[model samples]
Target: MDELMRRRVYGADHDDPDPGPRPGHVYVELVGGPLDGLLLDITGWPQDRLAVGAALGTELGKFGPGGRAVYGPTAAGPGRWAWEADSP
Candidate 1:
């Protein structure tokens, strides 16, 4: 959102979209491996699924066609999931 519009709708102090976790929505930061520094929105995902982490499929993977970027929750911090491995 533009600064003027943001100031009008979300107050002057709010310059950008809120990145904090909300009910039914969570944003995680990918910490390492190929897709580092990516912010993922994990809304509507089951708690169990989030706990175990996920194998996110990507076309830009090292293995190309059939690669999956595996990520898992870590003790690093809140909303931080580290790269576990890559699958082909």
Candidate 2:
């Protein structure tokens, strides 16, 4: 299976961060929901924006068309983010 898919299906240990991200880019792995295991770049975002997370629009979510998948930073897990909810 794909690495990200494996991690999502097989649990957290599969999140192997061996080589890590390219230099100068800040990435956070989104866990759960339709966007699970997707890497989001938050490189130049302000602290407030980072704190509030994002309402990302996607067609794959439970809400179907016009839906947004909300994800927020993982307080206990830096470099990772958690799904909050889905809204249409």
Candidate 3:
């Protein structure tokens, strides 16, 4: 998990047909591990990309397979953000 966080996590917009341009939505997916393929959605975040990624990483550190976590939007606005544990 430490290694994963150290590496750059790729992100894309929800509506993007191609992996280009920044969108309001962002997500980080685990490549391999017990939580392999798990996706953490940070779309509702109104902060910069770095902040969103940090939040996602912090949440992920406390998460495990079969576990879940949800975050409410920051002062940015109102929206529900969630991290889902994908079934292996």
Candidate 4:
């Protein structure tokens, strides 16, 4: 195995198309309320798995494998955002 295969950011439940990290499109997270929109520049990511994994590590605050989700106040943005997996 290589360094790229070592990173696993996707949940066993998420099965969307492989939108590589720094994907051209911004990921949106709308909770509690809505806004005109919050955009974060993700142009620095790659169009492959390596980029996606790195991005996940940056957001999750670590570079391991699996962990539970932790949620903070509601925040909408263009970049990547994470919340408790059970958050509503």
Q: Return the TM-score for each candidate structure.
A: 0.66, 0.71, 0.25, 0.19
List where candidate 4 sits over 4 angstroms from the true fold: 1-36, 49-88
Residue range 2-85, candidate 3, lDDT tens digits: 433333323344464554323454555543333344444555645765344332323233455433333323444332233332
- Candidate 3 regions off by >4 Å? 1-24, 46-88
Which ranges of candidate 1 are over 4 A from the true structure?
Answer: 1-24
Task: Give model 4's TM-score versus the native structure.
Answer: 0.19
Best by TM-score: 2
Candidate 4, residue 24: CA error in Å? 12
What TM-score number comes out for model 3? 0.25
Poorest lDDT segment (10 consecutive residues) of candidate 1:
4-13
Q: 1-88, model 1: which lDDT tens digit per residue?
A: 1321212210112354653333454567777877676656677788998899878776556777678888889998857899988889
Query: How many residue pairs clash per model?
Result: 0, 0, 0, 1
Per-residue lDDT of candidate 2, residues 30-86 (tens digit):
889988867776789999999888888877788998899999988778777889999
Query: Please, what is the whole-model Cα lDDT of each candidate in the order they appear?
Result: 0.66, 0.73, 0.39, 0.31
Question: Measured by TM-score, how close is model 2 to the native structure?
Answer: 0.71
Q: Using TM-score as the measure, name the better of candidate 1 and candidate 2.
A: 2
Residue 13, model 3: Cα distance from true site in angstroms: 23
How far residue 10's Cα lies from its native spot in candidate 3, in Å, is 16
Question: Which candidate gets the maximum lDDT versus the true structure?
Answer: 2
> If the candidates were sorted by their lDDT against the true structure, best first, what order would they fall in?
2, 1, 3, 4
